[model samples]
Target: MKQRNGSIQQSKLKQAEKLLQRYEMDTWLILTREGSDPSMPLLIGVRSVHQAAIFIRQDGQHLALTSVSDKGNYEGTGLFSKVVVYEDSMEEVFQELFQELSPAKLALNFSASDHLCDGLTQGLFLWLEDVIGAESLSSLEISSEKMLKELRSLKTEQEIERIQQAVDLTTDIYDAVFSQMACGMTEIEIGQLFVEEMKKRDVCNGLGNPYDPPLVCAVRNGLAHRKPSHYQTRPGDIVIIDFSLKYQDYVSDIARTCYMLKPGEEAPPEDIQRAFDTAIEAITQSIYELVPGKKGFEVDQVGRKVIEAAGYPTIRHSVGHQVGRATHDGGTILGPQRIPPRPEVEGVIQPGEVYAVEPTVIQDDGLPCILVEENVLVTNDAPIILSKRQTELVTIKKNQVI
Candidate 1:
């Protein structure tokens, strides 16, 4: 575990240096206290209880200015080349370090667009302004969004492996719970079965409340994100489960569609199968566009075109979003350009990013909308499917359920 942690730290440090050089950033400053910044663990390998300021210069210099109480946390990792501890005031040390670097463009963690890059709080910002004077602080480019988008969104080999494990476990749980599903089961009951299985594995929900992980929706519920209700699933109803599970701090997002078969019916109606097929094709075509250097919105258009050309209403949500530490891991979004927070969708895709591509088919018929989500990893050659793809509808019979 220690060796793996070191590898992650080394890999991230190399990536950060490359980004700093590419962006012409002279220095990258990270300030956190009492675990204030969520990105600290990813950037520094450990969260500090006391105040700390980590500086990374484009020339490959690494330094940490931390309180004496929390000196070992940063020093123990061997990540920083130098560790300076201050017992009283950090202003003198911080100012001295800034002057020593004499950075032309200092990058700070603050952004109007992305929360991942906006970890520096308002109070901390004010403290820096006081320490360095407002004129000097304001002159430097403070927003690290451009650099952080690449740093955080791009997953390392270890990160991808953890996400894949989470995906595998989630699909296994689905397989077990689906076999147990039967007629006369309420939507909530079916959801509970998933929760029970999750307990057996000792994992938590990837996104929302743990007790209510999967969003169980029947044909009558449409494609809403509401909690599972007392509504009982009947024969010939399409059941969609939007499920996710967190394993070792990584999360997987996958949605599966199941058709409850009537006694005589061996398969779903023609229209339902057609809708499912279209959704599957949309996922297949969109994943092909998930290569590095492609724009997020450009990849989104491929899936949108597939779904729209199939005579269904345009998908209401983005075809895909990044999935990592958080469900909406806040990097490039595979969505339309006009969507609010346009910068997210407009960002360029990079290798090592994992995305959950979900395309929804709106139905005018009595059936509900069909949705199938798959988690994919972006690579230089081709995108890899981390989750087992839901190609065909999962059929459940009243009596055959075990």
Candidate 2:
């Protein structure tokens, strides 16, 4: 479905106003030069080549201060209440806007934890200080981390629909590729099949890297994010395929495990079955705890505990992460608190936020790790599973050939 950008921008601006009130900030000042801040496109749906400042206020007023070249871009949107264009110097106009707004607690797009919120450059920050002077710089004490996190994380209805479309497309591609799988095919060859299918659909890789192969790993390979290798798939090998595809600007990330059976074997070995089941159980229990208002680490603990109880090694990575514009979209992370705990782990989960929950079960023996990742949407009630959940391990028959 094609998204209506106009409606989305209007909704976003309204949400920004509410977030401003929640954070007790007067204005959200986003400074950009040559499209520096990534949030600018998200906030204003426009990119500026020259220096620009977007002021979104708590009173639902929006203003844009930009070079004359980019003034039409902001005005065309009609989302901003005022568009102030400057030709020679932005200092005078910027100063005038600041004085008129008199934001006692100005929030800037800088964060200590979330990278998405840290778009202001060090040079621009120093320049802003010089423009506003010391006393006024003190008023720029607030960080737009938490507020921006919510603004981006809480997906609107249109966004959710767009993401759902991406998930469906990825799931279909997985099915087509798995159905065509055969024993003795090299990992690279199998990955090529996925590339071919994605080309037919005209969708790009979710990671946006042409070299980023859908991590196809045979039994001997470890659970590391690497390109597909020349290792050939053989009988009795457990193959894991971690794949993602981008639809529109949203992304879908899902992983599936496949077992290549030996001649005349009806099922996979007992150990393989046990490991896969353990991973599935971990994902199931963790998803149940993924309710709104819960901390990211709390959801992570549920999966970690389940994996440990099943006699597996402690997982090295987080159970899940926020999924949206980017595969590893920056926001609340479902992970453990380490020696120096991540501030993002303490971030609260909100309704409308989608997470890619991947609880992995690693084997010390020569068995492959079982990671059945699912894209889930957090709602007021039960979490909605966006991708088709992989329950049983996909088995490739000995007779099957590519």
Candidate 3:
């Protein structure tokens, strides 16, 4: 465990060094209390209590000011060169330290667009003002969005391995589901089967709502971001299953849409087929355009254009999103249009980042909706599809064997 923590710190430090050099930052400051910051587990490998601040200089110097109780976990990794601890109040000690290493620019973990970076709460920010003093706080910069996005979205080699394991598990679970699915099953019934199978297979459960997995949205009943219900699934109904499992702390979030065919049917209806093809093409085009240096909107445009060109109503949501620790892992967005305060949706996609391309076109011919979401890893040349890409609309026929 100690070695694993050390390795993660080393990897983050290496990346931080490069980011500092590229941006000419003076120091990166991360403030958190009670594990409010998402970077806490990744940086220190433990939940934190009491207020704490981690300072990383552009020259690779790491310093931490934390409560005595939390000092050991942060110090155990040997990642912090200097560890300052206090029993009661941190104001006196913290002010002195701030005076000594007065950074010209300080990166705070707050963003208007990304929630992962926006971990610092308003109440805590006010308390920190007293801890560091008004003068020192004035020197800070709200430029941590770019830094956090680059660090969080970009995966290391080991992280990719863990993610791949989760992805494969999800694919296997898909097989389990398709094998057992039949016509006349309720959405909740299928969901129950999924829960049982995941337990039997011992797959890790996802966060939020606790009892339920991610979601299993059936045709005409639910769309993107909606949960499943007791709605009965019928023959020729478009069924979309969206679920994920956790391997260690990594997550695999993949979704697939298929047609529930009647007896002796091999393929879905014509309209459904065309919609699936358009979504797949959009995904392919988006992947091909996802090389480094391209803006987020540019990659999203590839999918958006393909769908709109094919005469389908444009999807209101973005083309895709970054997937990692969380399903919508924040910052690195792959979307053409976004509402205000998320203006940074046009940021460039960097190599080593992972994303989920989900583009959906509704099938209005009394058929189900068509949405295909696949995972991808951004590379220098072409983005690599991470999960097993769906090539066709799966025909779930009666009495079909796996």
Candidate 4:
């Protein structure tokens, strides 16, 4: 794709070339059949019923081998530089072509540690060996994962703008939720309101396949991620409205907390205030430490120490996770604080990455859970918090006009 003017295709190809050089990959291969490889949607933006292989070379060349039927699909996008079509025998043609563009090493979409990277099916793996022969197979490595994580984590300017729009929409949806929320409203009712508002703006889930429902959990003492239920939200209840929106093929994971107050109440109870403050502090510390060259766990430690020092139970989840096309995006996560056995990715943090910083605290009065999650993008300097920070708790006034 030789288009200028900051097109999405330009961004994708630009990143692909950088990734090739960054990882020193000779050729990156993506093979799929019947859409078995979920990564195709992110990599190529389309799937094929017939078998196909897209090759990205270190020399900034993109080549595709596909059935005649799928040729137009890729060619239409202008993503690949060359297209080789096969009518009867794909194996015969691919093997001959593979010899001509001989690469020292080939990266396949397979990784044992990460499921998102493991898109190559067993049938395809076997088929590849049969088609390419043992010599070509000897040069194959499942290093696409390393490049994939890099590709997904490094957001282009266009992609960052799309993500910001999604976050803005999600923020607006939460604002509507707090505005209309009232005492004695069932969780299902409020959850429905969220869905209705998002639908009005045509916001979809961040994940593409199999639609996801909005999360509106009303819990008194503990925090949980669950579907909205029939449980009616009562006065003084702390509600966690976890919501995300898909805008321009990007998604946002934003969680906002609201407290239902009795009529004429001016401020929240001291216990609730303390919980919100502590959670905010955790988020603040994590954001401060979110810089390149630091380990992910080091950032996690800052958040966990602040929460635990305040005499609250540490969250049972990671301090933060990468957020992008998917809610739980790929690569280096801000590993859990105060949790045993760290993940390998906790070791490093990179610039041009985005993460969702979420921390939960059980209210001091033993009545509610206060959790605040925000999206942030790591820069060469300080991390940029994408969503508007929830500085004050949302108040629900019963029968009060907005």
RMSD in order of candidates? 2.4, 2.1, 2.3, 2.9
lDDT of each: 0.86, 0.87, 0.78, 0.79
Please report how far candidate 1 places residue 164 from its true position, in Å. 1.7
- The lowest-lDDT stretch of 10 consecutive residues in candidate 2 is 1-10
Candidate 4 lDDT over 19-53, as tens digits, reads: 78877777888889888886776667767979998
Estimate the TM-score for candidate 1: 0.91
Model 2: runs farther than 4 Å from truth? 1-3, 398-402
How much is 74 displaced in model 1, in angstroms? 2.0
Model 3: per-residue Cα lDDT over 353-401, one tens digit each: 8888887786544554777788888888767888998887777765552
**TM-score of each model, in listed order:** 0.91, 0.94, 0.92, 0.91
Candidate 1 displacement at residue 42 in angstroms:
1.6
Candidate 3 clashing pairs, residues 3+ apart or interchain: none
> lDDT tens digits, residues 23-128, model 2?
7887889999988997876678888989999999899788999999999888988888899999999999999988999888888889877788999999899989
For model 1, the superposed segments whose C-alpha errors exceed 4 Å read 209-212, 339-341, 363-366
lDDT of 3 at 154: 88
Q: Could you give candidate 1's per-residue lDDT for residues 1-402 as a string of tens digits?
A: 766776777778888899998888879998888888767867777778777898987777788999987888778888888999888988898889889888788788887878888999888889988988899888985678887887779999898988999999999999999889987789989989999999999997987776565999887655588888999988988998998899877799999988888878988889889999999999999999999889989999999999999898899899999998788888899999883558988898988899999978877546557889999999989899999888888888985542
Q: Lowest lDDT 10-mer window, candidate 1?
A: 360-369
TM-score, prediction 3: 0.92
**Any idea what lDDT model 4 has?**
0.79
Q: Highest lDDT: give the candidate number.
A: 2
